[model samples]
Target: MVINTGLANLNRYNLNFIIIFFYYAAIYGTIAVFEENMMIRSIKDIILLVISFITLFIIIFKKQQKDLFVLFVLFLFYIPIIIIPYMFLNLSEQSLLYGLKITILPIVMLFTGILLSNFIKKDKILNCFKGIFFIITATWLIQYFLGIEKLLNFGYEYGINVKHFYGYLRLPSTIGTPDGYAILLAFLSIIIERNIKNKKIKILFFIVSMVFILSSTIRSAIMYWLVAYITLFFLRVLTSRTKFIIYSSLLLIFVPIFLFIMSKVNNSLFSIHSLEDRLSHWNLIEFDPFSTKGIIGSGLGSVGASSVKLEEINRSLNGYAVDNQFLAIYYQIGILGIIIFLLIIFYILYVFFKKRSKGQLGIIIIIGTIVSCLFTNTLEIYPYNLYFWFYLGILIDEPELIETEY
Candidate 1:
């Protein structure tokens, strides 16, 4: 049984290498072509994550071996269960309704990955982006035909796309915008993570991805990528190779400091707005926690009574939707909601990094995505959700077993 299990794992590992190549083909290369396929864009990460979870539960029973932090995820996800329904009953609103659409993907995806940890093998995520040249070239051509490049540079208004939050246009390209595409590259690193043999590949991936992020001219995207990359670099120095504890410690310190500085710096080089507007957006608009909602919240899509009407929540915030996920979530779920959301993040990072798992790439990508999302609403969109889960599917299994057992 032991030998058979080992062989099966090896077989799956080899297959994953092939699967990942096509995965990134859709992610980095295809551009708007992937978007052309509406059904593809519609698929959510939660679906594959669910599959991964079921696959793992039946295989390893690695439940006992799962790191302490990840072990808590099962229960943490349920926090929304109580809050979502409660708000619906009390608030007489749709806050919970919209919030549900936004969060359900992550909750389902993460849960599936957690549940199926055993049978699934952790894959180095490289093959995912293997066909980048072909896919990207093809998509760029299509964009050319559609005049998307011109359309994007100037405005989303011309095309079917719409500009939202902070006066930025939204693209539905292969993986999406500068942040979306760049983060995908960063996330793709999860597959090549930490292996001395593939360090070049991973570093190169980071650089190329950053370039795409820059093209967006979105200060938030640039800042988020910078912070995540810098954090990863510094964390690498302190880490003792596979030293999980050191990695986590450094990440915690670096992230908050980086975010705070970005949030505050007045003469911040290359930021999106002038000093006055930036400050007003970041500091002045204090995240008004709906007092009445208390811990539970106003309801998934419930409306608020103060400042800006709850119905006009997205528009009143500056004729744009909330760019910050933390604030967006807080508004929907309240303080308890924020607390629950954060705890999940803390736990996931703890579990993900601790295994000294081949998730170094995944961690970086997640951090990059998180930082980028702070500035752009990547979480609420389509292909972004689909791509995030695909990356996640690679993250749930154990890479050690795949490499060693094979």
Candidate 2:
């Protein structure tokens, strides 16, 4: 079963296809079955755990990768314990069910192994991830063409209305929610950017990603994507504090004021209910100094605030959770736990920002993603976080592991 990959390029071994297929199957397939009641969440959990750990163990014990591999596994185990409390928290039976996300362990671990395998060959790794991204895009388009992507949204006032076909097609493209997909696809422009080889290709790619985003109708994600894209695209503008301050004052400050004035004059013309919900949800944060739950907070998945919020939102019309990552982590782990979670994320960001050698733009997108998740809940979902870790682990690993000072 062993094969030699002496050259360490994708052509040497076809692991890219394997990784891509498993990734989408697990992510989207699980989503398709999640609501259908066919596959037990526990079964997918177990299979991924087996595949993930088996891959990690083989890599770690193998002669070529003992130290780095072991350290990597430990790193994976160490950080996510931030999420382990829901099992014991004092919460309702239904609230406790939310802890099923611990199942995310296997998926993260599986990607971890992919990271370990990919470190030896960075291009293959990137290619594989890009391939998976395209798989999602391709499959979605296929479904769209078949008319299967069509579904209706039950409007509270207007009954069921035709909805744009997007994520949740086959794989739970949850993060790829109409807006979320746009953001990822827009970022994909950075992924596929070549050596400034051809002008037409770049313009075409940019246009296509934009088309995807605009049609998605996720205003929040779209706004975020546009802002992040502009910032990263002309990063040189931020190279100096004076320049950043000047630009921020003029663009950031005036743009909002102008938009506000226009929206007021136009009666806030294009408001989406989802945006209203997000704005309304901000009150829940309210810089609440008074902690609701004490240490160990309302039992990991207990009914403290989230259930109340759900009742309020009516399970986002059976969506079952908030769209804010910060809230999601905080509700489950409490403020202290969220701090730990952010610290882990901050560590990754710090590394990327400090070491701009590893494709700085990609790192920017990665960090931007983490930052964006704080305002919205994408990490709690699979695939996004899984892909984040996979890309990040390899990007960081592409360079030699720096030795620590004694």
Candidate 3:
């Protein structure tokens, strides 16, 4: 089941496109450093639209007729779920388009990943990821130690202020936000752990990843990393009771130390107070599932990050800042939409479980992502969201493509 690692059988055109797309996605935040350049910022959106259209073309004209039909049926119902809500809510065209793009991006990237699995070598993709990991690690280290204000101010223009905890800046690196950067590190760490066989190098990479993620001070990402590693350990690396006992003993030893550190921080940022504020905010947002509008939704772009562009609507809806990804979907698309979203996620997990090849990493990442969505609108985040869906398609559809380089 090993996938060929050579480019001889690869589709050069598709490989080039995927390479461009991923590399661009990797550096997307750096592009935002040029705050004065509107066109440069817009390139992210333009490239996204191009990818979406290209995905549509692949769906329409590619040889996977059965998959095309399934996708067609899925979107046949899915598009109207988005559009009808927009029309009913009388939202602006800009909002509608923006919403549409954000909502469908996962699907687009999924197909793109499928195309990637077929057209490109897995080693090439892994190499891209490794390269991205080093570059980001270097930049993040520089940003954190040097206090690079420009990098720190990356997302301020978008109203996302730099975060701080205990006199330390929650470094965003080049990813524009600490949370997004943390998410990226979580995924990269998994890839590094699974692919890199050198024990010392793997441990070094893990340590650096932890430091960077910890520097970000994103509790969810930190938890995700913990869970992903534990899942990987239990499922793949170790199957013996002794191994479990050893892992449990380590957790027992570290849990108290970790709690002590949290207690000492005394900052509300990582404390239960922050979580209470989130829950209280969620309580303020009312959606009557029994109502007609609730059945469909308030509309796309009526909530979450994309709604920020719809100033009036966003204001009227109290900025529509449903931080939880699931709640955001429910706010925008209603009960049916939420149901569809859950079904998609569960279905993917189901497939991964049943197929259960070398995709334990994928399963772990997906599980971590699901947990992450509970705390933040993960799908709304750039690069993380793109990588999330892209890897979903690749690892799930072509699990064999994920091979250990060592």
Candidate 4:
């Protein structure tokens, strides 16, 4: 791909303006925190909704194609799938609201990406993203060295306590937690690598980002980075024999060795205990709509992090945080919601594969998202979801016949 740094000549898209919402969302991990301040939380939600509607209006105004229409239909169909049961199940008001936020946020983010794709040239978007990436990474680095997170008031307010792993402070930077920081930066790093023109510079950036990822001690981020790199490698190498050899090595040798190392680390990054906790959460098959709740779920916000907070206010709920996004859907939305959600993913992946050439970077980034979603609620949660959907919009919103110009 060609690196287009000649931003001066390109038509103005000012699409970079949208980054503020994502920046704020991811920087603070507000949805996970800020439970005490309803006013602040409400403001954040309103900002997201407004931005989404504005982007949706742009997509409609610009004359959307069948693909966009299909997305629209899916978005429409999905609401009732969650909402209908939410109402009928007589779930707590908090659950309903939380459900709506997660459901609507991604759709809005999708539209936002579509809008950006239609107006801004890809090169410009990449150019602007580099600026954002550098700023965020630098801020994170500064926060780490200074032993302070108060650079942003909200950052200090909602931030998780600084964690120490391997005798170094686990840097959450402005994002509140190490896992949260790593997840967002991991995705952004892919975009940065795609955008940066110099190979040495790109590798340096990768090293720096990996430092943060490792220091943070978020095992899922490490797993995501490894899986994405290996997948990217497989995609780049063409020979079947080479592919087979690599696969055999990874499966037969590398994975077992890696697992052994993880076992020894006391599950520092991804421990057996961590795996057990995740499995225990998934063991809530009894709560499955097919098994219990029927067509609708207990309610929207009833299952995950939001449920934990809502539970305080409404003690009647058996709200437990489900680490897995897919299972979270089943527990909160029910059988039909889970099925519809899965179908949506299948359809999106099908579309992604069909247009793989047009959005190779996007495809690779999404593969990471798919893997991360299984282990973490990053996609369903805020800030993380913000970047996930926004980047996703940029990736899949390709114009037909749009091939990489480079």
Question: What TM-score goes with each of the models?
Answer: 0.61, 0.65, 0.86, 0.80
After TM-score superposition, what is the CA distance of residue 348 in candidate 4 from its true location, in Å?
Answer: 2.3
> What is the C-alpha lDDT profile of model 2 across 1-406, one tens digit per residue?
1344542453224355436534654355425433435355345545555556655665566554433444455456534443445455433555544443432342354345344554355555556656666765675464455543233211111111123322322211323334335455545545554322467776786677665555555454455556655656446456688877887677777778967874675432255665577768656543442455433344443332335434544542222355566665555556665555556555556655666543455455655666566446645434444555555555554433321111
Residues 341-365 of candidate 4 have per-residue lDDT tens digits of 7676666677777875555565676
Q: Report, for every candidate in turn, its global Cα lDDT versus the true structure.
A: 0.49, 0.48, 0.72, 0.65
Q: Which 10 residues in a row give candidate 1 its minimum summed lDDT?
A: 302-311
Q: Give the per-residue Cα lDDT of candidate 3 at 50.
A: 80
lDDT of 1 by residue, 1-406 (tens): 9966884685466445435534643553234433546356334333444444554454345433454235345445545644654745544434444444455434544444433344443443343444543354355345545654575564433323323334443343454444444344444333333442565665775555554444444465565556665656655655565556766677798878866774664223345464346335645333555455555554454322221233343433423345566655555566776776677666657656776635555566567667766655555544345446544544545544432100
RMSD of each: 8.3, 7.6, 4.0, 5.6
lDDT of 1: 0.49
Candidate 2 lDDT (Cα, whole model)? 0.48
- The TM-score that candidate 1 achieves is 0.61
Give the alpha carbon lDDT tens digit for every residue of 1-406 in model 3.
2434443244456666666777787777766655647677677778778877877786776566344355445655677788777666666677667777766665677777766666666787788788778877787787767664664454344225355665667766667677778888888878766777788887887777777776677778887787777676667536578878888788789988986886676454356766777888897555778887778888787778777645633434436667798888887888888887777777667767776646676788988888888888878877878878877777766676584532
Ranking by TM-score: 3, 4, 2, 1
Q: What overall lDDT, based on C-alpha atoms, would model 3 receive against the true structure?
A: 0.72
Q: What TM-score does structure 4 among the candidates reach?
A: 0.80
Cα error of candidate 2 at position 146, Å = 6.5
Answer with 1 or 3, whichever has the higher TM-score.
3
